[model samples]
Structures are given as C-alpha cells and as structure tokens.
Target: MRRIITVEEHFDFPDSQTIPEQTEPENDAHVNPKGNDPALVTTLLANFDQKLAYMDQYGISLQVLSDPNAVASTITDKQKAVASAQRTNDHLAQKIAQYPGRFAGLAVLPLIDPEAAAEELHRSVTELGFKGALIGGVPFGHFLDEPQYLPIFEAAEKLEVPIYLHPGMPSKAQRELLYESPSYSDSLAGMLGSAGWGWHAEQGVQMIRLIAAGIFDRFPNLHLVSGHWGEMVPNFLERLDEFIGKIPTPLERKFSDYYRQNVFVTASGMFTKPQMQLAVTEMGADHVLWAEDFPFLRRKQQVTDFLEAADLTDKQKDQIAFQNSQKLFGLAK
Candidate 1:
C-alpha cells in the first residue's frame, strides 16, 4: 500500500464548552447521519489510541487534525472566540506532540476579529508548530471574501501555509431560503442543507467569491486547501470560466486560472473514480491531496480499496496519497 497522509481528519478539544448547540448529539444526527455514532464522537473528541489503531489498520501514515466543531468560528463574542481558539490550538498542539510522527495539526482561528485571527495563526505556526489554519464555513455570517477577513489570508500568505476551507452548517437565512421545505421532514432538509448538498454548493460559491474579489491577485502565493473534491467547484470550472468572462470584473486572471494556481483539493471521504478522475484532470495530481474525513465516515476499507483500484499511474497515486501533502504541509518524510 502507498503511504498515506490524510489532511482533512478532525479532532476536538475535550470538554469543549464552546461547541455550538447545533453540533450537540441530538441535532448532529439530523445534520450528518454519519455522525450519529456516539463511538465516532468519542473518537473525535480525545480517543487518540483508537484513531492510531484505525490508521494502522488502514495503512495511513499520518493525519493532520483540526477541530470538526469549528468552535472558534461559531462563537459570537470576540473575547470568547479568541480565548477558545487559543485553548483549542494549544490542546491540539499538545496532542500532536504526544504522537510525534503520527500526527500534525491545523489551527482553528477566532475569525471573529480578523487581526486577532491573523496573530493567532502566526503564533500557531511559529510557536505551536501547526501546519496551517482551518477555517470552517462562513464565520460571522461573512463569506471570507469581504475586506474584514483579508488579514487572515494575508497572514497565511506571509507564513507560507495553506488554509483548509472546510464546510460549515448554513446560516439561518440560508436554511430558511434554500433548505426549508414543507414537503419533507426537518431531518431530510437538514441533511440536504449540510453534507448532502448545500454544504458543497455553498463552499463552491465561497471559492468563486474569493476569486472574484481578487484575493489571489492580491496575495499571489496564497495557497488554499479545499476538501470534498474542491467542494464541487472543479467539475464546473469550464462553465464558470465561460460565463464569468461575460461579466465585467477586475480579476487578474480567469476564474479557472485562479483555482488552478491558488488551490489544492483533497478527496475528503469522496472515493469514487469519476470524481477523483475529474479532480486529477482539473487540478493535476500534484495539486490533489488524500483524506478520509475520518470519524465522520469510517469506511477505511472503501478508501483504500478505491485508491488501489484507481486507474492513475503509481506515481500519481503516490502524489495523491502522501507526496503532495508532505510537500504542501512540510511534513517530514
């Protein structure tokens, strides 16, 4: 089996009082049925031993862990958010230290205050030895394309670390407008709004917003990691480029060009050949990373089986499995 480095793997701070109510056990089941397993949540919270065993069982060499709850992003109070983020990062850093070669960390930032978030990101990379920051969904109801969030992106570019853009639950207005339906149960609507469909759609829109706002133009070297096969963006890049060209904008490059240049995508729990082929075709093997979205989707055999059965050359498979991640995250070989 090829060495594997999964980047989208998640963990959470133990006794994290800041976890959003929506992420509580009862509601989480509705949002993501995969998370209904209490054992999964236990593993996500602090069961490092089980995580390591699972990795060993599946031949995974390393996992870059981040907070799945995205507590910092959901906390409304600035002070609380900042404190919670620091505490969470410190907790994760300690955990990574415990398992030396088996794990790396991604910082969770308090994006409520952009400047403070930037400072925390710098501290996380320099002091805590984290690989990068992971921003979960639309923080503070902002799409991250706004000027207020530029500091976080600027910090990432300056630090030469990629930011992982993980999906978050949609906001109230979004849910009411796009996901609510009298024809279906709330659970179905909740699922549809989240991991089922809306999550990917919203993430794709956010990426486009960043490009349209000239974020990449400003920070030309900024790197972003998007999971779930570019959040469904890569599949529609050609159409986006074609239509976006007709709209007048000051973008320095085509929509597709920005995506190709500044983004690295991961196969986070998406093991199908067609999506993998499309991602490799659109983003190139060098720009693709491997991930399992662990604890959420524990089908380790499916991931390994699909990867081994993939049609790509050995080198390309290696790149997706570990080489790309090592190069991007500066992981030790």
Candidate 2:
C-alpha cells in the first residue's frame, strides 16, 4: 500500500497574551468565545498526538497547513503579523523536522503586498524547506484570479509547487458584501456562524473566478487544491458550465474540463461514502483525496471505515485512499 499525503487542511496560529483580549463575550448562549478559544485545527492535532500515544491507533499522517495566521485579524499589524507568521512557520518546520515522515510545513505569506507575498513564497520553498504555499481563498478581497498577484502564481509555477487555497476571513470593509443575507445577522454565533457559511460560498466564487480570469491558461502546470470537497462547487458545476457558455465568451469548453485540469479537492470533515462518491464524480478518484480532520471529530477509525466501505475497485480505492496524494505531493513511492 502506498503512503498518503493529506493537503488542504489547516492549523491556526496560537495567540500571544499580549495581543489583548479582542474577543466579544458570549451571550452565554455561545460556548466558545471568539478570538480566544483558539482554532479547532491545532487542538485536533494535539488530541491526535495523545490518541496515537495511548490508544495504539493510527491512521494516515497529515501535512497540516500552518498558514492563514491571524493576519486577517484587525489587531495584527501587517509587518508584525508577517513576522509572527515567520515565527510560527519556523516552529512548525521544527516539529516536522522531528518526525520527517509524519509532518511537513506550509508557508504563510505576507499577503498585504503581492510582491512581498511572492518573495515570501520564494523564501518558504527555497530557503525554509517547506513544500508549498497556502493562500486564503480570497486574499484581502482580492481573489487568486487577479492579475496583480501574478507574481505569486508565477513563482509557484516556476517552483512547481501546489497552492493550497484554504478558507479564511475575508478582508475587513468587505463585510458589507456579506451583510445582505441571513449570514449577516449580528452576535458571535450568528456573525461567525454566518461568516463560516460565507467561507464556503466565497470559496466557490473564487474557483469560478479562477476559471473566468484565465488563470489556468497562464499557469497550466500550477496545482490548486481546495478544502471541504472543493467547497461545494462540484454540486453546482453544471449551472456554472451553462452560465459560462451562455455569456458569449470565446473560450467554449466544459467547466469540468477546467476544474479537472487545474483543481484537486480534499475530503476532510464531510467524508462519507455517498459524498465521497460525489467528490469522485466531479474530480475523479485521481483528483480526490481522503482526509480525517482529526481530534475535532473522532479519530482515524471514521476515515478507515469509510474507505473500507466505499464501493470502488481496489485500484480506484488505492488511488483515492493514498496513491493520488503521494503523486500530487511528489511523494510518489
């Protein structure tokens, strides 16, 4: 059996005490305090470590995303935030260093300036010994499809590394765009609940932007993978194709053609046999990878059970289960 490499998963940076308590107190209705409870991703990792040690149970290891640092939080100064990201990346790299087979690092580029982001990408890959770059699906209201940020894409292409577009908070002042819906309701749960809802929706829009902006045309070799099973875009791909075809554009091709060409999707939290089947339907087994969002949910057994029960050929199961990710991450063995 081939080893697996799970990309497109994230771990948020821990906040220093000096950052001040920016969290809004809950209505007592909300259990977790905003800005203070810490992101669940890393908490999951810590739990995973405990389980592995005591339970004698293990599953595939993850190349956890260490980007998407609190740079999005308003309290963070861009320069200071980038410095913090550097510190976190260095720390994460060391952790990976301790267990070479168990972990790998991803860089959090300073995104306020595109040129700086490009330079960081070069440093992360060229100097820090990291695998690839992780950018928020929409960086500061600028989608990855924007031409101004071509240098980042160009550098990733030049280095032939994957770009993991993990979801994060959109730029401030952009909140109004999300204000029109029920997602806009105030209160921590309602506000963040709505925003969490917005994350997947916004990501789907970003994927469409990538297609419409001809980004794939310029960087054909670039590998772009999304979390949460392409963030629900697969279910609506047909409508996307129809809209694009009717818009009087010169580029006439199936939307799936572009999707299958440049995109890969990970089955992280929403993994089940039927949904995993839907993921394969659009992305194919080669482009879809299995994942267990450890700790926050249950351990590796949930994922193992799904894989064991999936109705796929042994070879197909092998690809989705492990082989494809190894090939995608250049861990082909």
Candidate 3:
C-alpha cells in the first residue's frame, strides 16, 4: 500500500472536555448522527494513542489535525475570538510537536479579526510548521468573499498554504428552510444541517460566492480546499459556466477557470468511486486530494479497500491518495 496522508481528520481541544459528551439517537447505531462511530468518537476525543495505532494498522503515514468544530468562528468579540484562536493554535502546535513526523496541522483562525488571523497564519506556517489553516464556514452570518475577510485570503496567498474550508453548523432558519422534512425529528434535522445535506450546499455556495465576488481575481494565488467532493460543485460545472457567461463580474476568467485553478477538492471520506471519477473529470486529477474525514466518517478499512479497488491507474491513485496532498501542502514522501 502507498503511504497515505489524510487532511480532514480531526481532534478536539482540551477545553472540549469540559463540555459533556453529546447523546446520540436512542436507536443503537453503528455511525452516530454526526457521521462518527460512538466508539471512534471516544478514540478521537481521547489522546493520540489510538490514532497512531489505527494509522499504523492502516498504512496512513501522516494526518493533518484540526478541531472537529471551531471556537473562533462562533465568537463575535474580537479580543475573545483572537485569544481563543491563539490558545487553540498554541495547543495544536504542541500536539504536532509530540509526533512531528506523523502529524502536521491546519490552524484555526479568528475570522472576527482578519489582521490577527493573518499574523497567526504566518506564525503557524513559518514558526509552528503548520501546513495551512482550516476555517469552518461563515462567521456571524458573513461569507468569506466579504471585503472584511480579504486579509485572510492575502495572508494565505503570501504564506503559500491552502485554507481548508470545513463546514460549520448552519443557522436555524437556514436549516429549517433547506432540510426540514416531514418524517425526520429535530435530531435528524440538526444532523442534516451539519453533515448530511446542508454542509455540501453551504460550502458549495460559499465557493460560488467567492468566484462571483471576484476574490480569485483579486487574490489570484490564494488556494482553498473543500471537502465532501467539492461540496457537489464539480457536478454543476457546466451550469456554473452557463450562468457565469450571463452575469457580469470583474473576474477575467470564467468561474470554472477560477475553480480549476484556485480550488482543490477532497474526497473527505466520501469514497464513492463514481464521485471521484466525476470530480477528476471536471476539476482534473491534480486538483483533488484524499482524506478519510477521520473519526466522523471513521471507516479506514473501507476507505483503503475502496481506493485499492478503484479503477484509476496506479499513478492516478497515488495522486488522489497522497501525491496531490504532498504537492499542495509540501509534505515529504
């Protein structure tokens, strides 16, 4: 098996321990509502021993760690948010130090303070050796393309690290509007809001908003990563192109060109071979990276087996599994 590097894997901060473990649905289930196995959540929330053991068993060489959910994105007060982010970044730096070779990290920035966030990004990449930052979507109902967030994009471009835009929990109105079905209860609705359906829609829209706002044209070197198969964006490439032609924008290139150049999508535990085929065809193989979405979509054996059985040639498979991530994040083989 080729050495694999999984980027979307998560671990919680020590502060999360103060919060009690969440109750899952009453029905005995294998994977919990958040797409985590209860047993794996225990392991994920615990120290790194189980993770290392699992990685050793599965041939995963490196894992880029970030929090399962972000603290800074939710906090509105700039001082509080920046303080929280610095603490988180410092904690993450220590974790990576414990097992530097087997681990790297993506820092969590205080979106409320883009200038501070940029400084932290520089410290994370240059001082702490973090690969990039992972942002949970939309802070204070504000999207990334908004002018206030320009510093974050500029910092990412300057630092040469991708911003992994992971999904955050959506607002109640947004959830109710999009995911309220007749049969499901509040729990299932909340699940859909986070992982099942809403995440893909939200992140995909966020990507489109950046393109429409011409953020790519303004910060041409900025790179962003979206998990869960480009939040289903590649599948809509033709339609996006069609719409881009109709709308006027400051961007010199079509939306698809910006997408193809500036965005990198990951499988992020959605290991379906067909989805991989579609993404590779639309976005190109080099723009796709592989991740297990660990602890949440915790199925390493299944993921490894699926990749091995995938129809792509060995080299292409390598690119999806590790080579592309290696190139993007500057990981060594």
**lDDT (C-alpha, whole model) for all candidates:** 0.85, 0.63, 0.79
In candidate 2, clashing pairs total 0
Highest-scoring model, TM-score: 1
For model 3, residues 1-333, the per-residue Cα lDDT tens digits are: 687888898887755522322321121122153443466576664478888888888888899888746566556677777777777778878877887689888988877788888888898899888899998766667888889889888989988899998876666678778767788777777667766777678888898898889988888888999999899889888898897789776779888899999999998888887898898898888888889887777776866788888888888888888899998998877
lDDT score, residue 13, model 3? 70
Q: For candidate 2, lDDT tens digit of each residue in 41-137?
A: 3565444355334223545554554444344222335665566556666666766666556665677776666676777778877877777877764
Q: Which ten residues in a row have the lowest lDDT in candidate 3?
A: 22-31
Which has the higher lDDT value, candidate number 1 or candidate number 3? 1
Candidate 1 lDDT at 261 equals 81
TM-score of each: 0.94, 0.80, 0.91
Q: Rank the candidates by TM-score, best first.
A: 1, 3, 2
**Model 3 segments beyond 4 Å from truth?**
16-42, 181-184
Itemize residue pairs with steric clashes in candidate 2: none
Clashes of each: 0, 0, 0
Winner by TM-score between candidate 3 and candidate 2? 3
